[model samples]
Target: MGLKSFLSRPLAAYTVRQYQQWTRQPELAQQRILQTLVRQGRATAFGRDHGLGGVRNAQEFQQRVPVRDYEGLSPYFDRVKQGESSVLWPGQPLYLAKTSGTTSGTKYIPITKDSIGNHINGAKDALLHYVHASGKPQFLDGKLMFLSGSPELEEVGGIKTGRLSGISNHHVPAYLRRNQLPSYPTNIIEDWEQKLDRVVDETLDQPMTLISGIPPWVQMYFDRITQRTGRPVGEVFPAFQLFVYGGVNFEPYRRKLLESIGRTVDTVELFPASEGFFAFQDEPHNPGMLLLADAGIYYEFIPAEQFYEPNPPRLTLAEVELDRNYALVVSSNAGLWGYSVGDTVRFVSLRPHRVVVTGRIKHFLSAFGEHVIGEEVEQTLREALQQFPEAEVVEFTVAPRVSEAETEPSRHEWLVEFARPPQDLAAFAAALDAGLRRRNVYYDDLLAGNILAPLLLTPLPAGAFQRYMRSQGKLGGQNKVPRLSNDRALAGGLLSVG
Candidate 1:
């Protein structure tokens, strides 16, 4: 091994050792962070208004602060965006991550110097954890491709503002700069299709070993490269070994992604957001991510079922039980307090507090009170796929449909695009419907009572979802289709193109 590779393993081992200090006793780590956050919050305008100065414990903090969504917190956010200091956190924020919101329009999430450490470290440690466990550091020797947003950032209120991925691009470790792929000009193209074309041209001949992106976007890159070279991605670049991804569920696209590569590779799953980098998968064999409890963010949870109620209990890490769904909440050094990040998670292990992202608190099927969630839909679809190996899903979404005739539209319409269509369409639909009923008790009750018809599958032409995403200007870079909806907005859009 060369100097860098020789040094990396020891460094990784040391890093993993340091990480254990927190994960092994997250309750202590979390308590320390919460106390620090309270100290910081006491100096801000929001803290004073919320009576945070007198808070001495988690119970007091919980009672003092009410849970807030973006809209509820936007008043304080407005002051920060307009160049005010000490509005939320102490002093001015270093950056404001711009993200699209379904209800709040555009959101400007603060990224303080302190909070930025959480993002930068989580990403670096993800690789370090892999090196420490696998003892393979040569993946760093070859070109690493991170399919992401433009690095070009604009100024808002004297703070750098851009998409989170673009902001993160600026911080790829200096040692890895030479190993990173897709020229700067190619990344800043903005238009995703153009960027993909340029990325393909630039990386076609390079020795790419690590490729990273949201699944569908990376799959698109693989498709274009394979089409051009008439070979599997692994053949085109045999050095390729690590696949890093986040932003959405990876299982749905796993089959197609593997098929395109023609080989298995190491995959790391990340739970990231504009708010904070919450967790990352350490062990590839398991389906859970190690929660970043001490990374300048204090976590709290409200049982997912009680989340919509008037006053939901905010439970600490020590109080959370395993295998139960909870709406994940956070109070961070970024100046966001009692922030409901719209994500729901289930604890798989409490020893180190590993969690699986179950679904969004808002993204569910409840028009007829069926309460079907993303996890249920995705899991049901996976079971159905196993029953019919000939069928392959490219993309899919579920939306409720309203109809006058009982024989008309099915209550839950599943819009799907297939890479390999099933020969027995009726049988496939029956399997999916049955699997869903088995998973969701609410859906099963509705179906049995005849209050709702069985789910229906509407397969579209190949690349229809791609066309839809492209038309909506959300083709790539941290965007994914909402998996389940109570309304027909997404369903209507899909039907128009299908």
Candidate 2:
């Protein structure tokens, strides 16, 4: 079945166009989607009781149903966990993808047939864009490798526990199954001891062309493969052309990968999640432009200034402006309505409606980029960390400092809280300086002079993040430590470095 899906390019392209047409009609799409959500709510007994039955338009629906976070849907998620699809969908859900959020034990994201199609379409769109740009219909003609956690689907003991990647593998279409390199069969969750080794063994001699996954996992794969084969990665996998990565910033990790491969490989960024696939780099040459999958989502944008507004303008895809940064608010067929995924993005061009993901509003830092967010920093930080893993940061924060005197330079001050205490502070700082150079050329040149000082590493007192979370009445559950710092007082109170 998987092999059939892999080989049926014409059928795949037909399905892709069907998905794209949904987004092309901005006005009609909104009307149809609004009606569907209301109908779904009525069918599920939510609309009549709440008197939300008459939500005739998107605007009216938004007004009637206040925006809700995952915390607000705990009761609904719990019902799905008990194998009841009452609040999530109409029938028995196919599976639940486990996720950790700021205020829960674990979020059982219901993966229904409708939701699964959304994910598949999103992934297919990424591939379609690549094929269109490269003019390579047989892009997946060779071994296409994905370094996911594991392929285990159903779990016993009434618990759905595993990485999101593991759960997704079960729903892969039958036709595209052959494209997966069958090197490893062990469940990563069950066989944590040998997972990495198995991965190395599987791809050692394979002619892998397209590689995709998190930077850490991919980088680790390179290290293991190089050590096992006694050859550079380029020699081991000569067919590799496109490298797709996401989940964290690539800036910090890029230099190490380039050095290891000894050449620049084509790279693309994928903006996706277990809940849904949001966007992807549309053009190889232009990393900034991410074309929205209009068909799968009813798009909305909350301008950065109005992000916290009670009723921000939830612009349709047609209403979106070019070059303006806004947080994404989307309503999808997969049971998410008026939901903000917390990602911030800007339009590069709007004629084709392409966007550039700027940052996560929740993870913004006040620094060189006023709106500096996780994706940007992650890109640079990953490149840096690959070179100096010893400089692993347990926590970090950055703040803007005013030049007290004319002689002082205007710059952003970073207070890095490292995991391991370094014996030589200067050496630790210089290592970071070198790592940044490799990740971003501009940063490297800035550090060469006094423009940006070598980073200041402050070994934090162990358990600071845990202690801070406890103080906030947020302990003993999933929590996100602050990734970016603009609030000086909050940063100082929460963090202390030796």
Clash count per candidate: 0, 25
Give the alpha-carbon lDDT of every model: 0.91, 0.62
lDDT tens digits, residues 112-196, model 1?
9999989989998998898887888888888899999888999899999999988999998888887788878888999988889
TM-score of each: 0.98, 0.73
Q: Write the per-residue lDDT of candidate 2 for residues 140-226, one digit (tens) a residue.
A: 666777767665655522545455676666655555566665443643434432666776667677777777777745765776777
Stretches > 4 Å off in candidate 1 = 406-410
By summed lDDT, the worst window of 10 consecutive residues in model 2 runs over: 473-482
Collision pairs in model 1: none
